[model samples]
Structures are given as C-alpha cells and as structure tokens.
Target: MTKFKKRPSKLKKFLGLLGPGLVTGASDDDPSGIATYSQAGAQFGLATLWLALLTFPLMAAIQGMCARIGLVTSQGLTVTLKNHYSKPLLYIMLLFSFPAITLNIGADIQGMGAVAHMIIPAIPVSVFCVAFTAILMFIIIKYPYQKIAKILKWLCLSLLLYMIVPFMIKQDWVLVVKNTFIPTIHFNKEFFSIVVAILGTTISPYLFFWQATMEVENMAQSKRKIIVNKRVLGDMRTDVNTGMVLSNLVMFFIILTTGSVLYNSGIRQIDTVDQAAKALEPLTGKLTYLIFAIGVLGTGLLAIPVLAGSQSYMLAETFGWEAGLDKKFPQAKAFYISIIISLLVGLSLDFLGISPIKALLFTAITYGLTAPILIAIILHIGNNKEIMGENTNSKFSNVLGFITLFIMTVAAVALIYFLFK
Candidate 1:
C-alpha cells in the first residue's frame, strides 16, 4: 500500500503566500513615510498612533481590490484604463503620477544617503547616493523577478528594527496603551496638516499602480500552473492582509519610538529621516539610532525599485510597449530605459539643490491631491461588472472602499483648504 504524503507545515504555507502584496505593503513605509510618521510623533506625541490601527483595514481593502483587478483582467491598471476609459483621463493620471513618483524616489534616495553619511562620516552623501543608484539599477537590470523579489523580501527584515527600538528604551506601557485606543484630535491647521500628511503618506497613489501591476507580474513569474480561482484570490487576500498589517505595525512603532523618546526629551520639528535618526542618537543612545538609520537605507533599497518600476510600468502600459521585471533589457527596451531614466532624474534632484525634507512634504501634497481621484477610479473599476465580470467587489470590499474614498476625499478637501487658507 502507498503511504500518505505528509502535509506542509502552517508556517511554510504562510511564507509561501507572500508575494507582490508583501513587497507593495512594505514599500509603503519608505523613507519618506518614516519621516512623515516621525514628524507626527515628534510634534504631536502619541496623538497619531491610533492612525496605524485605523489605516490597516483601509489599506488592506484598497490593495486587495487592486490585486483582484490584476488577477481577473491579466493586465496592468494603466492598460485597463486605456482600453476602457478615455485617452485624456489616462493621460491626466500619468501627468499627476510621474512627478509624485519621481519626487518620492529622490526623497528616499536622499534619506538613505543622509543616513549612510551619518554612519560613515568620511564618505560624502553624494557618493553614497550615486553608488546606491548604480547598485539598484544594476540589480534591476541584471536579475529576474523572482530573485529581485527575494532580495526585497529580505530587505523587509530591516523594518523590524523599528519594532525592536521602543523596547530598548523605557516606554510607559499604560500611556501607550491609552493613546493607541483613544483617538485625539486637535482643532488647528498644524495638527490637521500632520494628519493629512499621515493619510497621504500611508494611503499613497503609487502603491495603487504598483499593487495591480505587480500582481500581474507575480502571476507571470509563478512556476506553478496557476489559475484565477477562489483559492488564488484567497491567497491574494492573505498576502495583502499580512503585508498591510506589517506595514501598519512598523508605522505604529516608529511613532511610538519617536513619541516616547524625542517628544519626552523636548525635541520637536523633526524633518527628514536623517533628522529623526540624528535626534535619536543622543536621546535613545547609539544603538537605537543606528537601527533606525539603517532601516531608512533598507527601505530605500526596497522602495526605490518599486517606485521606479511602477513609473516604468505605467509608461509601458500607457504607450502599449512590452514591460515586465522578469524580462531582459533586449526583451523590453522601452521599459528598462524608462526605469533607468527615472533613477537618473531622481539622483539629479539633490545636485539641483532640492532638499529631501522639501521633497517629502511636496510629494505628500501631490499625493494628497491625486490619491482621492485614483481611489474613485479604482472603486469604479472594482465594481464594474463589464470589466471585472463575476469577480466584482463584494459588499465587504465595497464598504471598506467607500469608507476609504469618503475619508480620503474629505482629507483632500481639507488639504486644499489648508493649502489655500
């Protein structure tokens, strides 16, 4: 008699489920995002810690819908919009998207370079920036999707340092617990601005494009004979939910670390990742500071590719050119060229005299304005029976999607009012 095969362990099954969703969610807490969250914690203390809990469900819901669209349509979101929507509509999105994504890349690169310079004062920030740029470009051009994805997955380990930080220093467990569960709102422009920044940074527009497109790419790279079925969608949800939870947890801990250490130490008005790291060195000691700074560099390594890849994919899809990270340079010349150009442009931002802090703030503003519109579009597509067929969003997804849309729309309006007020 044949022996029965042993089942795979639960932990192995969980690890196998991680993919595009994992990368996409981790990339959300890029250097720029860290700076935004740091600024919130530094300025307002634990007032914003509750946002991490609130955003997880909202973030997971939106990403889950995008992933589903990619699996069902077997096309990038840009291509779907081009095929089904008006030309001007698609172009408008690209116009808004390209600048924000490039600025974000430049900001992340600058943050990483700044933190690296902090670690090794002998090396210049410019040199570190150039070297990191070259290394990332080489990796993207040289490796296939699976290898690069594995590299990113490992890079995610760096974010856990943020979670490890608050434990190193003394934390008021009771106060932390109280602040996390209880929402606090201040009726002022400054407080609202940080709130908007947090919203814009966490619920970014770039991740939307990346999530849908990478889902398509992830499927293409899979060795198994896969089909878009309930199991597949279920796996996608698990991956996305797990990733978003990780992303939000990192955000929570960053705020907690900064809030407990810096705020209590009378430090406020922190700008940029380097500033946050530098402040931590004195207050929380060298070890905590290095961990925080190093996480910035790791996130840059993980995120810049996502930013550059998403931009390149959008351009490729808009123009009807072949594009995939799994494809070689000769196979996808336009796509690879676009990625290279975006990296070069981002690298030039510092040489052109733009500050990383300014880049982060401006990028947040741009996203705050554009993200709601994209959410509206994603919601429309998710619910479109002609497009999604039988896979249209369920009531649970629709409820979360509408809630996200409503909240983001209100934030966008508040942002505009604040900007012009």
Candidate 2:
C-alpha cells in the first residue's frame, strides 16, 4: 500500500510539470485535427504516418522558441512583434493570421456542434453551436484562467481513446511497423497534396500564436517576471519536447487507428466524429467507438477555449489593449470582448448552414497558407539575442528550424498555385 501510494504520488508530480505542453499538444488533436488525421488514413492509408515522425523535431523546435519568447519577454507574440519588428510587417502578418485564426475558431465551434449532433441527433447543429459557444464564453469570461487551464489539462486525457483502440484492433504488426520506419513518396499531385496538408496541419500557424501566448499565461501562473537566462531556455525546451513528442505519438495513433479500421475496410471518407466512430465499430469493436466518442468530447472541451483564446490574444495584442485571461474580465474588457466576438462569429458560421466537415478542411487549408510566414517569424525571433539573450537557439535547432521553414514555404506556395490554378 505504501509503495502504491508513493508511485501514484510521483505520477501526480510528473503530471504537474507536464500541464502546458500536454494541454497544447492534446488540443492539437481537436475535431479539426481528428478530421485531418482521419482523412489521411481514409485517403492514403498508412503512407503518411511516416511524415509525423519527420515533423516531430521541427514542431518541437518551433514551439520551444515560442515558449522561450514568452518566458524571456513575458509578452505575447503580437506584442513582441510590434516591439521587435516594424509595424507594417506586423500588420501585414496579422492580416493573414487574424482572419485565419478567427475562421479556425469558427470552424472548431462548428465541429463541436457537429459532434453534439452525434450525441443528440434531433438537436440542430446550429443551436448546439450557439450553446457550446456560450458555454465556452462563460467558462473563459466568468472563471479564473488557472481553473480553465486545469480543466483543459484533464479534458486532454481523452486522447488515449485513439491510442487504445489501435492496439485492440490488432493491425498487421509487420506492416504498421514497416510503415513507421520506411518513407514513401509517390511524387504525384495527390501524394504531394497530402504531404503538404500533413505539414500544414502539424506545424500550424495559429499554434505558433497560441503557444507563445500560453507561455505568457504559464509565466503568469508561475508569478514570474521576464528573466532571460539559459536555465529558462532549458526549461522551455523540455516543455516543448515533452509536448511535441506526445503530440506526434497521438498523431501516430490517430493514423494507425483509422488506417487499421477504415482503410483496411475500404471506407474512403470520414466526414465527422460520428462517421469515424461508426467506422471504427466493426474493425475495433463497439468499445472503441465509445472511446473515440469520449475522445471527441474531451478534445472539444479542451480545444474550444484555445481556439477562442488565440483569436482574442491576437486581437488584443494588435490593438494595444489590456489582455490575458489572468486579468479579470473588467480589467481586460478588450480581451473578453474579442473572445465574445470570435465566439459569435464562429457560431454564426455554423448557423449559416455550412457543413462542419467542409468548414474544418477549409480552415485547415487556410492554416496551410498562413503557416510558413509565421514559422519564418518564429525562427527569426528565436535567433534574436535581444529577445532570447543567452537562451538563443542552438546551431542544431537553427538548422532544423530553417529546413522546416524552407520546406513549408515551398509547400505553401505550391498549395496556393494548385488551388487557384
């Protein structure tokens, strides 16, 4: 009994250190995320699972830089950009990012309503969209930031559902194992398209804004001022590495679960969480369906606030108004108002009768377009000694970061050409 108690106590302490990274990483698998993963599995089978491995280090480096920015400056990305870069550049970047983030929040709320439609079919998605947006607003506007973060942290545990189901489905261990290591590129339009989408989704632009701001939130939680040093850099690295690794692992399982269950059975489309859940039933069993549903609900709860908060942060920072969930609503009226506006905008999109699946994919494509520029800014900021002090990026991290930026930029260009042409 003493041994058991001691181990559980140790686990709790470990988890305490893991809060921000886990919540951010897990939220990466929101309904939009699930849709992306499901589409990859349904369309291409396990071919793209290999890309998750490639993006892990790149994602970690970028996120680690974002965390360090906050720890060093105690300010969010938009604020820092305004101070560090020219105003015209800042506004131009925001022009791309703000609309993308706002649309994404709308898409996420719409996805949540779509999921709710699964649980109660008669209830219209638009009504649930409004209700869900209102509930998230109350939570953010009415509650403490720390409490919201904690709730998201716990809600994040729903990710394990996909992890558990993949194993239970009993896949071709040899093939799954083979695909994990071997990289295959078909080099055709569709293959390149999927590859681009994977990069876009994994290394998203909004995530850059969200991560940097959350770092400020984390610093606020620690009640620490901006103190630049190597130690803070080290801590930021650990936080990001832990988060990115967990995120990629979850990505792996999402692909594996869908590939094993859906692709193997010739199901080529997954439009909603409900479709994915039903598709998982025959291959992975009903228990897995329940697990998938639970994961959806949990991710929805965890991600909606993040979606809203990123938009709020951008809007607040761009205008020079007081912001941060840590500040009381009255103290940060612009911040809270931005959140409400984003919520309403998102809810209205759903009410307009746009298909949730289409909204998610379109939003994802928008992220694809906007992500590379954000990545460039992040890498540039990370290398700045004034901002990072002695905590500037290592040579190795810089090398990988540049490679990621280059690849993503090229992909973004190609995606735009292909889409419009």
Candidate 3:
C-alpha cells in the first residue's frame, strides 16, 4: 500500500494561490502611481489617505470580474468584445486605451530611467531609457509566461520598502488612523485633480486588459480546456482579494510616509520620483531614499510589460492575430511586433525632454478619463449571460463594480468642472 502523501505547508499553498491578481495589483503601483501618490501626500497630506481604503474593495471587485470573464469565456476581454459587441464600439475603446497606455508606458520608462540616473549619475537618462526598453521587449518576446510572472511576483517585494519607510520616520499614529478611516474631501481644482489622478492610477484601464488576458494565459498554460470549476473560481477570488489589499496597503503607507515627512517639512510639491526620493533623505536618511529609488526601478520593470502587453493583446485579439507571452516569437509575430513598437515609441517620448512629473501627471489624467469607460464596458460584459454564461457576476460583484464605475465617473466630471471653474 502506498503511504499517505504529506500535506503541503500553509505558506506554500498560499504562495501557489497568487498569480495574475498579485502581479496586476503590484503593477498598479508603478512609477506613475508612485508619483501620483507622492504628489497627493506632498500636497494634501493625509487628507487623501481615505481614498486608499475606499478603493481596495472596488478594485478587488472590478479585477475579480475581469479574471472571471477570462476564466469563464476562455478568451481575452478584447476577443470577447469583438465577438459580442459592435465593431465601432470595440474600435472606440482601442482608440482611447491605446494612446493612454502608450503615454503611461513612456512616463513609466522615464521615471525608471530618472531613478537609474540618480543612482548612477554617469549614465545618461536616454541610455537608461533605451536599455530598459530593449530589456523589457526582449523579456516579453523571449521569456515564457510563467517565468516572467514569477519574476514579477518577486519584484513586488521591493514595494515593502514604502511600508518600512514610515516606521523609520516620526509618524502621528493618532492622526494617521483618524484620517485613514474618516473620509475627507477638498473642493478646489488642485485637490480635485489629485483625487482623480489617485483614482486613475489605482484602478487603471490597462490592469483590466492585463487581468483578463493573464487569466486566459493561465488557463492555456495549465493545459486546461475552457470549463468553469468551483475550485478555480474560489482560488481566483482569493488571489484577487490578496492582491488588491496588498496594492492599497502600499498606497496607504506611501501616502503616510510622505505626509509625515515631506508635507510636515513644508515640501509641498513632487515633480519627479527622484525629487520625491531626495525629499525623503533628510527625514529618513540615505538608506530609505536608496530603497525608494530601487522600488521605482523594480516596479517600472514589472509594469512596462503589462502596459505593452495589454495593448498588444487588444490589437492582436481585435485583428485576429495570434497573441500570448508564452508563444515563441515566430509563432506570434504580430503580437511581439506590437510590444516592440509600443516600447520603442515610449522610448522616443523620453528623448523629447518632457519633465517626468508633468508627463506622469498628464498620464494620470488620461487614465482617469479612460478608466470609467472601460469599467462600464467591463460591467456590461460581466453581466452579459451569453459572454460570461453561468459565471456572470454575482450581486456582490455587481454592486461593487457599479459603485466603482459611478465614483470614477463623478471624479472625472468633477475634475473637468473644477478645471473650468
């Protein structure tokens, strides 16, 4: 008789549960996101910390819907949209998302190159930009999906530096707790813009595409047929929840650290990730600054692929060309070329001499406007019985998804109104 197999350790099991959700969540805090959060903290202090708490549940639900759509339909969101929605509508989405993602990629690459220059002043920012562009394009084209995903999961550990930063500085735990749980709103244009930027950076449209496509990628990687199983759905929920919580937790602490340190010190503007890191040196010393810089680099490496991959996935799906990171270069020529073109275009943006902070701010605003449209479309697909079949969103998911859509729409309108006012 065969002996009973020993059970896997709890930690190992939990680690196994993480995948698309974890990567998606971590990628949400890319360089652009860091800059936006830093701007929020430097300008409004802890007054905006409450948005972090508010967004976690909403982010989880929206991403969960995306993951379910992919898992159930066994197709990327774009493919599903192509099959079920009007061509004009699909093209409309592509028009909005493509440029926004490209701009984000450019801003993210710029941020990474800026931080690299700060670490090694001898190298020019253009060099770092070109190097990063080449490296990421190579990784996407050459690496297997599983290998790239594992590397991204490990890179997420770098974000822990933000959490540790607040402990190194003097923090008002009393006020931090109060502001985190209590909602605060400022009606001015700057505050409104920052709020929109924060929301945009947090619940981004690219993550929606990435989440759904990666879930499809996972299915294909597992060699599983397109079938819905209860165990798979449960695992997806756990992964999405854990990932969103981690993303928002980092956002909260980053805001807290900057608010306690830079805002308190009367440093009210962060024009770049380098400036933000440098501003923290006097309060938390060089070590913290170094870690912050490294975090920017690591997250950028993790995020640029997702941004480029999302665009490629949409284009390939729409045009009926083969697409998947797991495929060989020759097997998915159009897909790989799209990724290469996006990276190169973004690299060109770096040489244009746009200020990193200004570029990032503009990227955030673009995401803010585009995200709601995508969210509304996602909600429609998730609720469509033909597309999602029995895997359609439950009441809980629908409520949170609609709430997120509503909030984002209002924020978008508010941003424009305040700008004109």
Candidate 4:
C-alpha cells in the first residue's frame, strides 16, 4: 500500500518552531545576567520584577528585526553592514564587540568555575576554569552546526531549574503578585545603575549579531531553497518571541527566588552567580543551591559558545574569512582558531587575577554604550527598501524599535553619568 507520511505531533511541531530564537533567548540569561538579576532582587527585593514585563516586547521586536534582516539578506549583520554601511562604523563595532564579548565569556567561565568549586571544595576554581575552557574548545571544534545547535537547545532546559527554586521555598504569593504588577522606582545612583545593568544585559548587542548570523547559518544548512515569505517570517517571529518570553520568564523567577529567599532574610549585595548560589545554601539548603549552581554551569555552556562564536563571526565577516558552525575546523580554520583564542583569553582572565565581577560590570557597561548605536543601525537597515525590499520593518516593529532605541539611549547615558557621578 502507498503510505502517507506520518504527521509530526504537536510537541514535535512546537520543538521544531524553536531554534535560533529559543537558544539566543535562553542564553541571554547567562551567568552574568543571573548575577545582575540576583543582585536586583537581593538588594531591592521584588521592586524590579515589573521591568521584566517592560523588556519582553522590546527585546522581541529587536531580535525579530535582526532575524528578518538575516532572512531577507541571506547574510549575517556584519556582511550587510560591510556592504552597505561605512567602514569606520564596522571597525568600531568590532573593537567594542571583541572586548565586550570576551569579557562576558571570561565572567561566565569564572562564575561557572566558582560555582563548581562551591559544590566540591576539593577542586580548585582555576582548575575548573581551565577544564571548562578545554571542554568548550573541544566541543566547538568537534561539532558541526547541527550538533552544536542541538546541544544548545537541550541546554536551554537548564533554565527551568531556576523556575523550580522559588517553589522549593515558601513564598508570599500575594507579595510576588503585587510586585509583578506594580512598578517600583528608587531614585538613586545605585538603583539606576542596577536598572541600567538589567537593561543593558537583557537588550545586548552580541545577541543581535548572533541572532542574525544564526538565521543565516540555519538557512545555509537547509537543503531546501529557503524563501523569505510571510509564512517563513511568521515562523521566525514565533521563534524569536518564544525565545524572548522564555528568557524573561527565567529572569522573573530568578528575581523572585533571590528576592524572597535572600532579601527577606536581611542578606543582599549578590555580586556574582557563585555568590548568589552560595548565599542560598545556608538559608534554602543545599538542594536549591545545587540547582542554581548547575543552572549557572549550564548557562555558561550555552552562552559561551554564543559569546565566542558571535565574536569570531564578527571577525570572520569583517575580515572576509570563512565562518559558520556548520563548517568543520578544516573548512573554517580561522573561525575555529578565533573561538579557541577567545576561550583561552577568557580562561586566562581568572589566572591573570582579574575579578569576574568587575569583568561582568565592565562587559555590561560596554554593551550599554554600544547597544543604542547598533539598534539605530539595525533600524535603518531594516527599513532600507533596497536592503529589506518587501520585508521592511512594519509600523508596529518601527514603534517598538524606536521605543527600545529611546530607552536604551537614556539608559546608556544614565549608566555613564552614574559612573562619573
């Protein structure tokens, strides 16, 4: 008998819908972001929960535009900029992006190492840091795009562990609900700095590059002639929005966890993910701490590849070198070499005596300063009829993108002002 193809189950369809956006979104809540959110909650209690509501739409809009840019252009953001924009702008992005992404990788590696040390006092943090660097390097070189993408998708589940932590302890549901809906503002340098950190960390520049490049890579690997059409864009939008929502939900639960467990007990000032995990052990016991620590490590594995890969992709595109996760090391030697160098440099930060907390804060500031400019460029690229053709930014997207630009501009200024003030 002639057989009909078995239809994919809804679960499989949903999973299929998830790709670059989901991984990018989940990676956004990397170890450094965890530190930022944990600090906000520990220091200010539930005051910042409402910010999650505000950022979700903004992040989705920007990431969606980026994915669209990649889809319509069939090229990474860097290539588009290189072809259309000025060389000065492209080089400047590279300069800031390299350090910003490298520092981010360093901080994540350190955070994961410290958390591992906490779990096993016998292992030295430096050793763990080096070991992680080696393992990550091997995986990037060993795996092609599909394998790496699959691994990243699976690692996204580690974020759910944070969701579990809040339920493990008794929480004031009413207080959490009140804080979720109510916006709280404290007018001070410290408060505004944390606000900027959250903004900068969530609406990051590297993820924009990574998202677009990933879409291009995804398309390149497919055997089918991927056309950029309404249905395709719709799927892309679904993926990006789903990722943004997942990322912010993890942020919400993390804030809730630290706000309830640490803030209520009179502890505050969580500067690092390891510190946040350590702080939880005494109060919420070892299990919650273990979950949080493991999540940190998982986020590092998910995020570092993104951090390093985006940096390398930026360089690859800028220099016209071969690139893509799909290319084997021999096929993309420079690409893999850059990844190795980034990981090594990041690992060296710990051994070089640079503090991870400072690295993370600097990384945030770097991103804060650079993000607004990149957003403006993305807006222009998205709207340029020659570049995007029929896939230009919609009115709603333009509105959200402009709002994000305005907010990020104000936040960037505030972050700098606070630094000098």
Candidate 5:
C-alpha cells in the first residue's frame, strides 16, 4: 500500500512562505537605517512618520521586480546587467556601488561596536568591532545558505522591541494618526537632507542586490531548474509582501517611539545608539534602553553580512568567479575573500575617530546619491521584454517604480540645491 504524505500545518506553511524577502527586509533595518530613522524621529518628530507608509508600496514594487528578475533569469542583477549593458557602464556602476557599500558597512560595524561598548564598558570599541567582524565572517563562511537565512530571520524578531516600546509610553494618538496619513513637507535644508536619508536608507541599493540574489539562492535550494509555475510565483509574491510589511512596520514603530519619547523630551539630536537608548531610560524605563540596544545589535548582525555578501556576489558575478553562500570556502575563495575584505575594512573604520552616528548618516547620504542610478537600471531591466519575458513588470509595477524614481530624483535635486544655496 502506498503511504500518504504528511501535509504541513498552517503555521508551518506560513513560516515556509518566508525566505530571501524576509531576510532582505530585516536587513534593511540595519544599524545605519536605525540611526537614520532615529535621527528623523528625534529631529523632526512625527513629521516624518508618514514616510514609512509612503515607502511601503514603492519598496514592495521595486523589490518584487528584483525578485522576479532573479527567479526568471536564474542570475543575480550584476550578471544580468553585464550581459545586457556595456562593459564600461557595468564597471562604472560597480565603482559607484563599491564605495557606497563599503561606507555603509563601515558605519554599520562602527555602530555595532559603539553599542557593544555601551553594553560592556570595560571592553574597548575596537575589540568589539574586531570580534563582530570575526564572528560574522565565520558564520558566513561556515554556515550553509539555509542555516544563515534561518538565523537572520530569527534575528528580525528583535525589531519587535520597537513596536512594543511605542505602547509603553503615552502617545498623542490624534496627532500621530493625523501626521501618519497626511504628508508633511518642510522646505528647510535639514528636513530635505533627512528626508533623502530616510528614503535612501529605507529603499537601499544593497537591498536591491540582496533581494535579487536571495531569490536566486532560494530557487537553487528548491532544486528547480526554472521558475515557470504560477504556484511558485504566487508563493514568492506572498513572501516578498510579508517581508516588506514587517520591515516597514518596524520602521514605523521606531520613528513613533523616538518621536514620542526623545523628541518630546527635548533630545533633538541623537549622535549614538547609546544616546538614543539613555534618553529613553527616564521615560520608558530601563527595559526600553535594553531593548533598543538589543535591536540595534541584532539588526547590525543581520545587516553587516548582507552588506558584505551583496558586494561579494556582485563582484564574483561581474568577474566570473563562483559565488553563493552555499559554497564552501575552498570552493569559492574569491567570494569568501571578498566578504573578509569588506568586514575588515569596515572594522577599521571604528578606529578612524569618526563619530559612529555621523559616519552612519554620511553613508546614508552616499546611498541617496547612488540609489537612484541603480533604481533606474532596475526599472529598465524590469521593463525589458528580452530580460524579464512574460514576467515583465505590470502596469501598476511600472507606475510605482517610476514614481519611486521620480521621488528619489527630486530628493537628490533638492539636496543639491540645499547644499549650494
């Protein structure tokens, strides 16, 4: 007699739906992003909270297109770009991406180090940075893709602390709700710069690369030669949507918590995660500070790997070296080396005497400058029939993609104007 196969339970199935999208989304809230969002909250109050809502659809569309590209083509974005675009253009894009990603990694490692030092005063920040770099490199080199993804997914739970913190403090629900739904525009230079930073950090370039490659990784894990089935596509949509929602929800709460506590308490500037945490102690108690610190550390762990990995993947693909987190160190020496170099360079930034929060903000500004160029390329690829085939972006996707591009372009132009003026 033939035996019946056991079906997965609802919870099991729901968990199964998550993959690269979830991990990518979680990584989006990295230390730098936390710094940017926290700065926005502390500096501007609830005026910027609506950005979390506004960016959700735009981010989902762009990332969904990226996921579709990987699933359909069975390649990372860099490989696809190399195949279609000129060698000169590819090199130029890589040149822009490398430094931006490097600065981001450096800032993130520095942020993590600062937080580590905050938690343990006796240990120096340099030691923590070195330790974090070593620990993350070991995990990426030793763990298989599935295990790494699982660990990252669990780390995302730390962001729930942001959601919980908001409820612990009294809030002006009327003002919060009003500001969240209604857009608030400030013509000031500082506001414009922060808006650009918020947009840049949220819909980041690293995430673009990570999301696409991750879909490719997931396809490999499934042992599928091609992604042609409607069911498979549907599952991907579910995963991407779920991940983006969770990412933005965490962003929303972070802004809300800081706006209610830090901004209201007259702490208008947040130079470190420590300052943000300490300012919360009097208002939300010690637990709030602990949770914020943990959230920053957790997100840093989740994000630094992605930052390093995205660079490795793009470089490996561009240079025709074997790449994938699934491969052993011996099998993918270049890829592994790329990761090590990124982490070490980032770790060194901690000793540069630059303020962690300032470095983090500067990285966001760099991303803001580079992200639009990458987004434009993504849109072009998503709409190219030869590249995406029937999976080409729908009208709705195209509309949202262009809107996102336009918004970023305007922000960039506005930023330049403010700088010159």
Candidate 6:
C-alpha cells in the first residue's frame, strides 16, 4: 500500500512539471507545420534538414521569455503590452498578429477537415470541418481547463508516428547524417521559400502568446501565485528548452521520414497529409498511411485549441475583458466568444472550396511574413525588467532573440521579392 501510494505521488509530480512546454511543443506540429516540413522534404530533400537543428535555440529563447513574462506579470501578451507600452504599438502589433493567427486557424480547421475526409471518405469535408469546429468550441465552453489540457496532452502522443515510421522505412543513414551535419543551401528563390517555410513553421508567433497564457493557467491550476524568482525562472527555462528540443527533433524526423520515402522516389509534390501519406506508402508500406492519419488527427486535436485560446486571450486582454481558460464561460464570455468566432471563421474557409493543400502553403507563407514583426515586440517586452523582473532575459537570450528576428525578417523579404520578381 505504501509503495503504490508513493508511485502515484511520483507520477503526479512528474506530470505536474510538464505544462506549457508540452502544450506549446505539441501545438508546434500542427497541420501547417507538417505541411511545411513535408514540402521541404519533398521539394528540397535533406538539403534544408539542418534548419531543424538551427531553429532549436531560437525557439527556446523566444518561448522561454514568454513563459517568464507570464510568470512575472500573470498577464496575457496583449494585456502586458497594453499595461506597459503605448496604445499605438499595441494596436500595430495586434494588427499584424490577428490576421496571421486567423489565417493559421483557418488552415488548421481546413486541415482537420481534410484529415477527416481521409479517415471517413463518406462524410462531406465541410460538414466534418464545421462539426469538428463546433465540437471543439463546445468542449472549451463546457469543460474545465484541466480537462481540456489533459485531453490535448494525450492527443499529442499520437505524433509519435513520426518517431516510429522512420524506423520502419529503409533509411540511408550515411546521407541522412551527412545532410543533417553538413549544411546545404541553394541561392535560388525556391530554396529561399523553403527557408521561409521552415522559419514560419518553427518560430510561430502564436506559440509565444499561447505559452505565456498557459503558464499563467498552469500556475492557477496548482493554486500557486505567479512567481518570478530565480528558481521559478530556472524551471521555466528548462521546460521551454526541453519542449523546443523535442519540437525540433520532431521536425528532423518529419523531414527525414518524408525525404527518405517520398523525395528519394522522385515524388516531388505534396499538398495534404493524405498526399504525404501516399508518398510514404512505397517505403513505409500500408501502415504508413495509418501513421500519417494518426499524426494529423492527434496534432490537430492539440493545436486547434491553442490557436483558438491564444486568439481568445489576446482579444479579451485587448478589450479589458476577463479571460483565462480557468474561468467559467459565464465569467469569461467575451474570451470564449472570441475563441468560437476565430474557430468558426476558420471552419468557414474549408467550405469556400479552397484546396486544403493550397491553404496549408498559404498559411505557412502568410505567417512567415508576419512573424518577424511580432518577434520584435516579444523581444522588447521580454527584456524589460520592470515587466519581467528577475525573469528578464539575459543578454545572451536577447542577442539570440534578435538574431532570430533578423533571420525571419530577411527570409520574409526574400520570399516577397521572389514572389514579384
């Protein structure tokens, strides 16, 4: 009896430690992310594989700052911005984030519908998309935050398909390691677009807002005061670093799996997860289809809510309304409504007859163009000790954060240039 009790206690402690990072990291591999990675693998093979390694530190630094900011201030991103910065900057930042994030949500909803079609061919894709959107919104409104988080956490484990499917395929280890360790690049516009896609996929701005708000939710779950001491900040950094590393590792496997299976076979095109799954068939066998479906379904489950919730957080904070997943819908009506509105708008896009594949690519490029501007705001807020206190970013973190911002901005500009010329 004593041993069993101790075992449960240990398990509970371990589970408690995994909060924002797991949610943020799991959400990172949303449908759009998978598309970006799959496209990279299909179009560029293992040449851009090194981006996964390169994105690690940048993502960690950005998300860790967000988490630290939330812990210190106990506020959402827009709320913090409003309270500390001028309204013009807040409004400008909101303008950039709102459109990019809404587009992302629409893409996720469309992707979810696409996956539903893959799983249940008889069901109309539009119906499934609207139904899925409603069901998710209903769950958020009816369920407690803890329940929602737990459900998403379990769903995230489905992404293990990326980890498992690679082993089932015949991989060229020599070339795989060579491409991973030895960097490769092409100066052409397509190469630049792939770079932009990778940037958009890994360093997404919504994750920053989501991580901060979720950290506050995590603290509320434990009934702990939001603390910004050295110990708390250290723990937050560890969580962010762990999550970022896991995210990039997943990115690595995604490209490796697709590159090894699809690109090596001269299959140069993919749009939806189904296409990617079909591409995986020759090397990974029939089971690969099952793996791909599970990955999409699982990641969609994890990601869509964060997308909705982050939008909810920002809008509520912007208008001075009560917000937080922990709050009951009656108490946070504005917040919940904002979430549903974003979701429904997203769902409606699926019915517009836009190709799911095209939506996926559009989502990546749109977000990529907007991410650098948002990152600059994040860097500014994170470095201000008055807002972050002891959790303020170190000089090293600030430098890395700005470098990431620079790279993203440059890639986005290059993408635009190629689009016209």
User: Which model scores highest in lDDT?
Assistant: 4
What shift in Å separates residue 47 of candidate 5 from its native position after superposition? Answer: 0.6
Ranking by lDDT: 4, 1, 3, 5, 6, 2
Give the per-residue lDDT digits (tens) of candidate 6, residues 182-211: 989887788888898788878887788889
> What CA root-mean-square deviation does each model show from the true structure?
1.1, 3.2, 1.2, 1.1, 1.4, 2.4
List, residue by residue over 89-163, the lDDT tens digit for candidate 5: 888878877877888888888888878888898999888888888999899999999899999999989877778
Clashing pairs in 5: none
> For residues 1-421, what per-residue lDDT tens digits would candidate 2 score against the true structure?
4554444576565565675666777778787778778878887789888878988988887877777777777788889999988999888877776665666677677667766776688998778877877788888988888988888877867876677777676778889878889987775665666677677667877777888888878877775465657665665666678778877887898888888778888998887667887787777776887787777777877887887788778878888889888788899998898888877877787667767666666666677777777778888898899887776778998898898888787877776666666
Q: How far is candidate 4 from the true structure (C-alpha RMSD, Å)?
A: 1.1
CA lDDT scores, all candidates in order: 0.91, 0.78, 0.90, 0.93, 0.87, 0.81
- Model 4, runs deviating above 4 Å: none
Model 1 Cα lDDT, one tens digit per residue, 285-313: 88999999989999999999999999999
| Candidate 2 C-alpha error for residue 391, in Å | 1.8
Against the hidden reference, what TM-scores do the models get? 0.98, 0.92, 0.98, 0.98, 0.97, 0.93
Off by over 4 Å in 1: 1-4
Residue pairs of candidate 4 with colliding backbone atoms: none
Of 2 and 6, the candidate ahead on TM-score is 6
Question: What's the number of clashes in each of the models?
Answer: 0, 0, 0, 0, 0, 0
Window of ten residues with lowest summed lDDT in model 5: 223-232
Q: For candidate 3, lDDT tens digit of each residue in 1-421?
A: 9999999999999989999999999999999899889989999889999999999999999999999998988889988889888999889889888877888899899889989998999999889999998889888888999999999999889888788888877777999999999999988899989998999999988899899999989988885475677898999999999889989988998898888888989999997788899888877899999989999999999889989999999999999998888999999999999999999888888778766667677778888998898899999998898777788889999999999999999999999999888
What residue pairs are clashing in model 6?
Answer: none
Comparing 2 with 5 on TM-score, the higher-scoring candidate is 5
